[model samples]
Target: MSVKETAQEVLKKIGGSKNVESVTHCVTRLRFVLRDFSLPNKEEVASIDGVISVIEQGGQYQVVIGNKVSEVYDEVLKELDGSDPTDKIESKAHHKSLFDKFTAMISGIFMPVMGAMAGSGMIKGVLAILTITNLLSEESGTYIILYGLSNAFFYFMPVILGASAAKYFKMDIFVGAVLGAALIYPTFIPFASEGELSFLGISVNMMDYTSTVFPVIVAVWFASKVNMIAEKFMPKDLKFLLVPAIVLLISVPVTLIVIGPIITLLSNVLADAVNAIYNFSPALAGAVIGGPWILMVMFGLHWAFIPIFIANMASQGYDPMMGLLLANQFAMAGATIAVGIKTKNDKLKALSLSTGVTTLFGISEPALYGVLLPNKKPLIAAIIGGSFGGVIAGIANTVQYSFGGSGLLGIPLIINTSGIDNGFYGGIASQIVGFIVGFALTYTWGFKEKSTVDSDDYSGNNTLLNTKINVNDILSGEVVALSEVPDKVFSEGLMGQGLAVIPNDGKVYAPFDGVVTMIFPTKHAIGLTSSDGIELLIHVGVDTVELNGVGFKSFVASDQKISKGDLLLEIDLAVLKQSNFQIITPILITNPDKFSKVSHENNNLILAN
Candidate 1:
């Protein structure tokens, strides 16, 4: 499906735009805050074509969309243009714990800026490479310009974060930016270093706000609350002018006097605590963090660490946490490759190999969800491998000088500002240990290929049926070839073959006398196993699962015995058609391998008999 289609499908399944309280995208996922959390079906969202997985954690509904998340995010934004107005309903977030709300706010503010941050970090990494090689002197004009390019984002972080945080807090974006600018206004910067200062006869706590995280976010939040009060009291005619004026007037001074110093201190404490843990025992810290890194990513808990990472970079100019994460990526890749090599299923082999390569490039969601996690053992092996890599990196005191790099490509990020050192070598060694150990362990005993017979390879099943199973049409409709069905799973015969029908009526009769094996909660599909052992699937419409059972009606319960002509389901054909869902129903022989001569006869005319 096209990215736009994926976005639309996702939007529909998540209760359309009305249910979304807010939405944002991080590196590889679309995070949503919803008004009604129960509206979305996790299974349906995950099954969307471009979606990798669905996670509900930290009070956010996250749909993993791999690397193209930004594109999908843009499309989602376009579709959400008419989203329900704020104040119309209370967000589900209000009931979440303080920590959940805080994480959501952090992710909302930081996610938009991460790309630029990563890009700037990469520029710094590249500059390091050039300077170390002696190809570019630090004193050169070119170096000066490149250095500025690398430093601009971090140096002016407050302004960028102000704009993003404004969106989250529902304040004027430029006003939020101006509030940030007030902290580092060029004329006011000198007083911070000069020590004692007073504003409006109140002693102002002077602190440099450059490259900071928490202060600006807190400031914007404060401004949003103040703006809300100003709106309520200020006269409508003068509200626009005075509200912002009053907001900036009150917010700027309050932040300089109160929020800035407090948050900065807390941020430092957090960063220091992290460093202390690593310092106490690098190997143990590495093992502890590395062991569950993939699981953290899966649950969307990793976003909580972004602030600490930025704080480390701001205070120490280097961060060790990223190295542990990179190790996990290599471990995931290694385990995935092993699965590819060991899996006997051709489809699984292709998926494993492709997702393995993606993991090597720093996108591990596909590998973790599609391959390793499903197999269980490979996931354990990957975690074990990552722990070892983390230990090695910890012992070497490896740190990332900048961000943006992951997997093997991120090796340059470990180069210390002084020059190439033991840390860089440690990073390389860690990845090697991670990949090799993950591969070796998984290859040795982590995986066992499950045997299955491919339909194309069937030899002994040619004449196995002792009696002919005559199938009848379950619905009155125009017969359509299964190969022409819109869904690939049916069109390609991947789910076995039968035929499709464009229904002119709603009722579905049993195709053969058998027990109903399954009935999807959405009621868009049903499964049956014939008395003679023929398994059949009757799916009402292509992509109709997104309808959430709105127009589908089940007439028979699962495990119920039925005759060939018994009523089974009732689809509201007009309702489905009105909603733009294709009403072409597919009747499939799910176990076509058991038949030798599966053919449609009598001009493909199927009738209940």
Candidate 2:
């Protein structure tokens, strides 16, 4: 089906475009704020073509469509006559819970700038390595410049955060930037001294805002509120002139006098809490912290520790909590590598290997999402491995001297400048233990191989060998780009690129002589390998995996020979449409690289050629 047709159907199933207050999309879901939740039929919406699932969370009805959500959202906007919810209406109408609102706001504000922050941190890590090795002089101009480059992002964090927060808060970007700038202004910071500072007889408290998180965020939220009020009351002609002026005038002083001091006190309270936990029992604290680092990081709950971590670093020149996280990332890397080595599936192996390398460097999301989470046992093994490593770290009382993002580089970062120490050497030993324990445990007991032959194996991608091979048209129907497939695994060409078809006939014909190596229980997906070793995976309908065997009838079974034009499967199109399932079947050349070049005829064929 055409994208337009699919979009129209989706809109209709969700109570039409008129019922939608606004629509947005993330990586894999279409988020909708409806005028009335009672108006839309959720089960029917979930059954819609191209939809993976339906979720109602955080005051939004979400339609999961995998990687192609952006495309569908664009189509949705067009169908809605380009009407979108205004900023004020969106902020007011979402009705999200406090926790949800706070997390969403923080994630939205930090996501864009986080890449540069992490990258620059890695650069600093490398410089630390060079200096430690005596390969680069710490006093060199090159070192100074590169170090400055690394520090600049964090030093002016408020500016970057303000711009992003302003967009989320529906305030002027320039005003937000100015708000960030005023916090870090050199002259104003010195005047923060108690009894030494006054602004027109109002006492000013000495509060440091540099490299802080809550103050600027709270200030921006206040500024947004002030801006909205200013807009409502100010003259229309003077809105542009007076709105920002009024907002800044109210927000800055309020932040300085009230918000900043309160947040600083809160930061101290949070720090004291963490310190108390560590002092209770470092080993138990380390184990508890290390086991769930990934979960904390995923939900952004780890931000709560930022003030503590930064404060510890400033006061004592190191943070012990940093010691706990290093083990966790390395353990994740180890688990992923074990999966890569133990699995027979090629795609999973490749994914695990790549993600494992990043995990080793303290970038664990790839490993977390791609390998560990999907495979339950590996997650358990990695966490246990991390706990062991954390216990080792706690016993040694490990501390990191420098803050750099890489877990692999943490070894060097922890090294004391004057000389070597037990903490640095013990951290290395702990990471090694983490890697070994994670890999060994997962490889031994965690991974479960799929019980299937060539066709159903989830791992392999390319199976081409050295020789000339026959290339024949796979399916005879209306051809569509593989990228048009709503599922990211196929649409991104990650599963091997091939066109799809809207079957002209209800029956699926075999494209080449092959053995039906695998036939799924649902009969929605079939896998075959030709005598020449060309694997083909024919999946009928978008997200039909959810439908089980309904409306699908298989004529062939596993280990059966399939000749060209032989009837393989039959589908009841009428039943499919009534069930709200798509009829766009993807005929993928699962191992396209096996042939020098592969192309489909995409021709109208009454019978197989």
Query: Number of the top candidate by TM-score?
Result: 1
Each prediction's whole-model lDDT (CA)? 0.81, 0.71
Off-target runs (Cα >4 Å) in candidate 2 are: 1-96, 193-195, 314-317, 401-404, 409-420, 453-609
lDDT of 2 at 359: 77
**Steric clash pairs (candidate 1):** none
Question: Which run of 10 residues does model 2 get worst, by summed lDDT?
Answer: 600-609
Compose the digit string of candidate 1's lDDT tens values, residues 195-225.
7578889998788888888999999999999
lDDT of 2 by residue, 193-287 (tens): 53455666787685767766777888898899999999999999999988988888988888878887888788778777888888788778778
TM-score of each: 0.74, 0.62
